[model samples]
Target chain A: MFTRNPAGLAALLTFVLSAAMVFAQAPNLGKPVSPAEIAAWDINVLPDGSGLPPGSGTPADGARIYTAKCSACHGPEGKGGPSARLVGGEPVKNMSSEKTIAGFWPYSTTLFDYIRRAMPWQQPRSLTNEEVYALTAYILSQNQLIGERDAMNAQTLPKVRMPNRDGFIVRFPDRTP
Target chain B: MNKTPSDRIKRELTDLQAVAGNGLLHRRALLRGGAALAGAMTGYTLLPSALGQQLTDDAWSRVPGSTVPDYGSRSRFEKDVVRTLSNPKGEPRTQHARTPHHLINGTFTPNGLHFVISHAGDPDIEPDKHRLVIHGLVKQPLVFTLDTLARYPMVSRMAFVECGGNSAPLFSPQPIQASVQALHGLVSCSEWTGVPLSTLLDEAGIDPKAKWLIAEGGDSPHLSRSVPLSKAMDDAMIALYQNGERIMPGNGYPMRLLLPGWEGNMNTKWVRRIQLTEGPGMTFYESRTYAAILPGGKAYQFYFMQEVKSFITHPSPGLAMKGPGFYEISGIAYSGYGRIAKVMVSADGGKSWAQAALQEPVHSKAFTRFRAPWRWDGGPAVLQSRAWDEAGYAQPTRTQLVAARGETAQVPPVTAFPSQHYNAIVSWSVERGGEVKHVYA
Candidate 1:
């Protein structure tokens, strides 16, 4: 089996052997994550409306649904709670007052995405997209932003400026405003 | 004499004391005693011989039903100690959560209630697919699978991983009236067992030119930061096991890098990539944020070492003292530098000091529990606890940290922007009604 030049074949053999060793030894080298996966899970929506999901809801529809599914915890008038009160948009001069969805939170999208993922703790993710829309609408209506008869959809959801939109600043390690 | 199980539990403490040769032998004794107390077959002189036998029998076995673990947790009794959901309605996958410290015991936080601050949400990453890559300035860039890591001999240590930004809320002018655990519980201790990173670096052959190694997590947005290579080679561990078993899902499951005594963020979770680079990873986390300026205009950079600190876990705010008859003042004391040697509690502010009895087996970088017998006179008393570590570092008050750093002087101007890292002597004003509220007398 002698050949004029077996050096190329020997080199080829070495390369193949080395490649096999690398894979066999380290089987789980991670691949660069894909963009699609990032989008699917990055559900955090900023107040300036950066991560708002595509869809919409009206205050009128939100009200009817709010009374049915949400009012149980948030209270019928959205002011008291078996659950959290949805009213009270701003902290008052009185530090002892109860701060609710309006006064305590800094963003409105937090409400939409929050309800979309974690509402009805006993039965999370039980609401439909339209129902979440309607519920959001009712909350906005209760907040005095939209009318009870108005419909809200994704296009309008981000545009529904929250009264406390300017209230939030990113809390980080050090540096205060 | 061959003593019964309970007697053994007691002897374990003595043995532990003998082993430590230091006052910290209480635990070695208790654990050994507890084991023997359960296993001893012989009877003892004290109590009924049947009681000794019963102790042995109890040690020999738990009820068949109680031993069966289909779905498991630390214990139902320890269930009151749990993590607070930061977002009542955000994705549990990425949302930040924390442990409830008001109800815990001793210094070690159960793996379940350890605090979490995740990025890009929590990835349901499979253990089989976990990988750790070591590249950058090295003789050879290498990728390590979990099995390959397991093949190496492991070292177990009761170490702590604390967030550099832990106790962020303490900067507020007002007392954050939550449990001490909720506020500072971002720090937790576990007996982490894994391969020392130095061994891997030795295998891969770290370059003399390489100054920093950037660690990146497998979570989306994959939190990353640059750490000094010197620190990595010193005490850094690629921890695969936490508290004896595989790492918890919330903690870097499969494997995470435990940079002892350093900030928690540097201990990346779901740790897949380790690029050996001289520069920072440039991830939005470590770059744009985490760097804060100090008073003299110099910035506190890299990972920060948490100073000596201790918090009274029991009898915290929102906790009722039950009219203060004979109450046990118990809590955890720990330091990033080394073991905590002393803990002193003051019932009437820091006017008087009484040494707390430290539990045995006081390990390095782990929580050391201390307890003291207290009799509340049902009057106005401000309760506080102070811890001193072996390094001679004492827990500082808020005034010291603020005056030293001069941080945020311009931020709030007059409102007195709460100083971050305000390791002040927290006081709790105990009322006659068993009500406890955070106070700064």
Candidate 2:
């Protein structure tokens, strides 16, 4: 290599050095984590139901869980008390009207995702996957969006189309990923 | 004897003429040493003082100061200048602490008085135990602790985090009689110093299929929001320090996700996890809480940016004018798109507008303070400020906004959110008696 022109050799060396400097900028202090180590904290469920866990429950099963764990704040049968009313809503005549599950929610997976992540206001994420599915089923059935006996699970939950499924218009399509 | 500062202020005022209707003076009047001259003669002329009183040392000047505290705090006299809390007892529901904008000035919101809306109240998180995990759609799953993150290359930027529901009360059919704090207190700006999220993501090696990332907090609610990967690669930061200090507990101590110019709800506080994915999670917030219903019954979804907005903070509701002489009309103007380009003050509602002077070094996505001189004529007038962003978007007038997004059927409570993303002009009516009230104009 030294037999080549001196300036050409120097240019090649400079190119390699600059690339090394650029790639080495980051401190790279993060520690590698295993899938098992992250299993406990990875609870997010997407609209496509990719993150939904192994669970199954019917509206009947959800009614019992809602009465025991959710009724105090959300009221009996999701009519709503101190917290938001989860069961019913009108035709959304104006912006100020109460937005209910039947009236505003566009995706059914959001019900399961929200209930699993944050519900029973006082204690969240303490419910099991079965309890979350049950509560989601109970609210959906109460809103007359699903059958009373239909079971909700990873496979069937995403299929339940909400009433307001076509009610949303993406505000900024260019910025949306 | 030297002429008093009040005499100098009066002499300076004589040369300034009204640039617009309702005695709106030129913006340069304040820059020409008018405010500084008026500052020296503030209390004596405004308050009832004995004539020819001799200058003497007051009690505070005669005594030594109190012992210094290990952690410095605001003076006791500033105790009343605090955030107004919606739920002081920490009830089961969400709690809100609104910043007192009228009582405070400048662009940076003090950490103590920064607005916070904790869904399940702030958690007492130990910094040592806290860990941030970034997994999914990455070449390698990585976990970072507070200590590890502190070692990364850091950058500081002044940005604003505004709640989507801020200024929602303006959507009511009639103006709500409330303070500026009650109406527009959910938004605040701070200088955040942090590690660029792209740096860490690049270290982890992002997968090409990843389109969005779900950010979750460590609070009880485990509040989560989905952000576009494009934004994460843009100006997003894992903010660890706010205003050169460790972040406040209420404002997400240890760390928080700071998505500059985005809706506040997307800036997940107490951020513990970021899971990259192919699509939006459509979390409860984006799906329901933040979606604003339009007049046609279709709701606006994924409305991330806080649009251009401005409101006069001085002489706002509850801040009555003092006898209607020379007054400096000042307020804040900001935008999520970019820097505020221009701010026009109209003393006659939307008619006869005059330009206001914008303070220098106007950082993008941060509050830009604007001031204009006005000689209040002790007559009825409507005060309004309209801002234009660098992106060329003008703040909408009340009629323009209401036409696009219909108003509420009934007047809403000051705290209730009638709609989301209510960015429009705010009008304050100055009565003949110098009292200012919220008006629709």
Candidate 3:
């Protein structure tokens, strides 16, 4: 599928040959990526609970994990200390209180995805799948969206309706004029 | 220090005034003193002389002794440095630098002065070690090194990438007293050269059910964004060159996704992988940050396009008008939807507007320079520019914007975060003494 002009081809050939002579080796442009290799890097989770790893955790377990890992940045009660607040605020429509995940986030899956990929601020992606699930459950419980003993898994997590689930407008109509 | 070009011009003007006679110079000096006194009596805060001196013509002049031997460097005299803002901790690793828009003219923004907003730190990637992998729901998963990717057919286009938070401070109830660049400098235009993303997707043979593509970067935090398949196949490109040169390190060196006219955050820098997906990735960037919080509590998610916007660059704050006789009012206009069809300039606070001359080669989804000739009568006036795009969207006034969105109280410690798409008509109030200030008219 790759097409190059004659001049470009000539330039590439010259570059490859000269570089090979200097290093005494021909460069391997690239190899076909295998499915296993793709699995190693495919970490994204969708709104529909796709790409979620097989794991489960209770909110009680999540509270302890959050205290040890996330409380430093998110605050003891998830009311925001230095980083973003995870709970306790009105939806963005009120415009009176600060926006928190409980008040503003529309999808619960984002909480799991973000925590798995870029949470803890200092050491990201170091959490196990169970730890991620526990943290997600703890944050949601603190938001009062779920009970303390509720077990969160791929199935239960996607079913939890956030307070701002219907608070988002997807159609960005051109309001220019 | 050697005298700058502007300093020399000012010296020559002073010499001419001296050679002419004492009468004219004396009268002019008296008038200036009286104006300053009047401004002082009216309690109008004046810009510091030191700051005003920096805004001299030298700020807009090309760098002296600059050469393009193999690489390019800005002129030594050019002092349009990017202004930065960081968190209270004073960490330099994570900070945002605003472009000096007021100091620059024309559409092309210099590479050095381009605004930078990094969530984590910029990554250091070696081109030879970098690899782009396309996988997931594709017939053939392919991985290509930089050299192999460079062999694809190339295309070039001029476009603007604006931060979703560009002009976000305008949402503040109280007007922010700052230069135009400090206020709305996050957006910049450039000539980008790359291979169309469709070519690679076609080569990989995308699945019929794949509706979204998750583009991930190699930067720390591994910044990622989900792009629709339609946009990916439409105008998306794997940019390798910026402004006729290899992409700068801060701007995704070896390769980056170029989503023309989309929010700058969506243009993932240091791009590493593209995974064809069946749904939105629902990353933090899309769901939490960069989402616009509208009035009545409904936040607008995944709003990508930056609407039509324009600003008056010359005669803005910092560049004090020298008597304001015959001035060429010049500014830039751009649209995310399409080309700028018309730009109207008004000197009387939108009372009446005259169509400005649109610069040639007005490319779609790019910055188009506009100019108009105006003779100030040494009176108070407000200068404003309104842009219209081919989509028939005209820039709205601040009042209209606030009305459409909800108005927040202009109280101290204001923090009513509005939507990210703020393209209201900006007005600059000019005093009789030639001082200008940003105003909402």
Best by DockQ: 2
List, residue by residue over B339-387, the lDDT tens digit for candidate 3.
Answer: 9999988888887777777888999999999876555667888888999
Off by over 4 Å in 1: A1-177, B1-67, B74-80, B91-94, B279-283, B295-298, B405-420
RMSD of candidate 1 to the true fold? 12.9
Docking class of 3: acceptable
lDDT of 3 at B138: 90
DockQ of 1: 0.03
True-contact fraction per candidate equals 0.01, 0.85, 0.58
For each candidate in the order shown, give its overall lDDT on alpha carbons: 0.64, 0.89, 0.77
Q: Candidate 2: which pairs clash?
A: none
Q: State the lDDT of candidate 1 residue by residue for A58-133, as single tens digits.
A: 7766767777776766678888675556865454222122334555444455566666655655455577767777
TM-score, ranked from best to worst: 2, 3, 1
Q: Name the best candidate (by TM-score).
A: 2
Per-candidate TM-score against the hidden true structure: 0.60, 0.94, 0.81
iRMSD, model 2, in Å = 2.3
DockQ of 3: 0.32
Give the count of colliding residue pairs in each prediction: 31, 0, 2
lDDT string for model 2 (B1-441, tens) is 799866776676566678899989888788775655444324344454736687899999999989999999988899999888888998888798998999999888999989999999999999999999999999999999999999998999999889999998988888899999999999999999999999999989999999999999999888989899999999999999999999999889889999999999999999999999999988998888888898879888889998899999997998999876778888999998889999999999988999999998999999999998887878999999999999889998989988888888888778877648888999999999989999999
